[model samples]
Target: MRILAITDLHGNYSKIIPLLQKSGEIDLVLIAGDLTNFGPDEKAEKLIDMFESPVLAIPGNCDPKSLLDVLERRDINLHNSSRTIGDVTFIGLGGSNPTPFNTPFELEEDEIESNLETLINEAEKTDNVSVLLTHAPPHCTLDEVPAGNVGCRSIAKFMDRMDLIVCGHIHEARGVMEFGKSIVVNPGMGSDGYGALIDINVDETPKIDVQLIKA
Candidate 1:
């Protein structure tokens, strides 16, 4: 199926506008996190209004609980939930490990790990190929920063072989990587108006093709 995966949008609508226009014949739009500058309902609503396909979003470090609450009102599905479309099972986790900034949507290492374990188990029960969508990168994989310190070792340990791992939070490492039979992609900065389009086949070898879309 064709999917448009993005993250760290931080309220940039110009980029999103083009992305929505270019996304044709897409079955789903997966948003990793940072949809809003903080946690504004209107921003999330505006994004939801632009899409024709089903959108799955998770809250990022900057996302406010109020935003999540408002999303519930809009009947939008939030993370900590699982959804299946076509031959793929899309699992989402919001927020990231605690950072120096004390962001609003921070999660502890253990918290993320435990939650990830549960998600993994749940995905295993499904008959479809698994795809993990998260706001933080998994350890030394695609989660590196310009400072050279890789983030979330626990995440890497919990990351088993999956069809694809789409993440954000590390803006510099905005690209794709093939690791341990899984295609890991970080769409860079939603704030910068850049993201990725991924096409995947869930059967057999689970082929994945990613296209970088920039404004």
Candidate 2:
């Protein structure tokens, strides 16, 4: 399967066109978060409509809480929910742990952990590969800033449990890393034309290929 993942859009919908064009024959598109810059729900749908392929997305700290209902109406919101498509099961959670800035969608670490736990239960299946789609990066993995590695510790603990994790929020921490049996990828600021293309084959030895790219 080939997946195109974009994050931190923050309402820069124009950047997505080039990324989509470059990512040919994509089986799915995953939008990590920040579809708006504290903008309205209309902005989110506009971006979602731009994608021709199936999309599974979550809201970001910058996104208004109302966007959740919009995403759900579109049947694309993955927040605290799980969905299986093809041979992959996607479990997702939106929002970030409390930031000093107090963003609109920020949540406590415990709430984030509880949401993830429930999502995992619904996503876990013996026959399908499980992928976690989160707006916030797990602690100290792809989450770093001038302040420190202030990521969700609860998410960090689940690192070894998933087959793959696609996250963002720390724009500078954009890259890929291997954590035990899981592959973690942060596609960076999609609003700035940064994205990632991941290819996976269950039969392959490594099973995952991650590439960071620009629009």
Candidate 3:
């Protein structure tokens, strides 16, 4: 499967669409978050509707909670939910653990932990490769900012349980990490034309490859 992952798109669709245009045949487009700039939801929807490939997304800290309705109506909201396509099962968690600035979609740390516990348990039922789709990168792994790591601790602990982790929220820290049979990638800030293309070959021996891109 060819998965195009992008994040923190603070409403500059023009910056990233060209990257997609050149990306051969993409099976899926996963937007980590920040599809809008504190949103009108209309603009986000317009961008999303332009995609021909199937999509799944979670809301970012910058996204208004109201954006949930727009996503729900289109059957693309994946927050704290799981969906299966082909041989992959994607589990999504939106929002970030509280930020000092009090962003619109910050969730408390404990609540974030609890939600992941539920999401993990549910996803474990499947034998399909598991992908955790979250807005915040797991703590300290592509999540560091000038102050320190601002990712959810619970996410870090649970990450190894997934086959892959696709996340964003820390634009400056766009990067990738591999540990314990899992790979985690932050597709950077879409408004800046940064994203990643992931290819998964589910043959007798499954393997995955990633390419970070700048449009």
Candidate 4:
């Protein structure tokens, strides 16, 4: 399956069209978070309407929790949920783990853990490969800040079981890393025209390929 992963758009709808145009033909689009910058639900709905392919998305720290309603109305909200597409099962956890700025969708560590556990349990029941889509990166992986690593420790501990993790919160920490059996990717900020392309081949032995793209 070919997938396009984008995150932290922060209400730059103009970039969405160009980004999709550059992405070419893709089977699915996974939006990590931050679709709006404290904007209204219309902003999120408008962005979802622009996509031709099926989109699975979650709300980011800068986005209001109400954005989920828009995503739900469009049938694309992946927050704290799981969806199976082809041979892949995607589990999503939106929002950050408490930031100094007090973003609109920040969640506590315990809440994150509970949500993730439920999703993980559901993922375990599926025969497809498990992919984690989270707004916050795993601790000490792609979530490092100059001050320190401000990622979800629970996510890191649960990394070994997942096939891939697509996350983006810390812009400067954008890149790819391998932890245990899972591959972690941070697509950076979409408003800045940064994203990642992922290809998963389920024939014979499953193969995963990823590339960072800038528009």
Q: Against the unseen true structure, what C-alpha lDDT does each candidate score?
A: 0.79, 0.89, 0.88, 0.89
Mind giving the per-residue lDDT tens digits that candidate 2 earns over 104-176? 9999988888888877766664568889999998898988899899888889888888999999999899899
- Look at candidate 3 and give me any clashing residue pairs: none
Report the candidate with higher TM-score, 3 versus 4.
Answer: 3
Model 4, range 3-58, lDDT digits (tens) per residue? 99999998886777777787899999999999988988688877888888999999
Candidate 4 stretches with Cα past 4 Å from truth are 204-206
lDDT of 3 by residue, 14-43 (tens): 876687876769999998989998887887
Instruction: Tell me the lDDT of model 2 at 52.
Output: 86
Over the full model, what C-alpha lDDT does candidate 1 score relative to the true structure? 0.79
Clashes of 1: 0
Per-prediction TM-score to the true structure, in the order listed: 0.92, 0.97, 0.96, 0.96
| Candidates ranked by lDDT | 4, 2, 3, 1
What does candidate 3 score on TM?
Answer: 0.96
Tens digits of per-residue lDDT for model 1, 92-199: 778887788888888888888788788778888877778888888888887666677556766787566577889898878888887776778898897677778888
Candidate 4, pairs of clashing residues: none
Clashes per candidate, residues 3 or more apart or on different chains: 0, 0, 0, 0
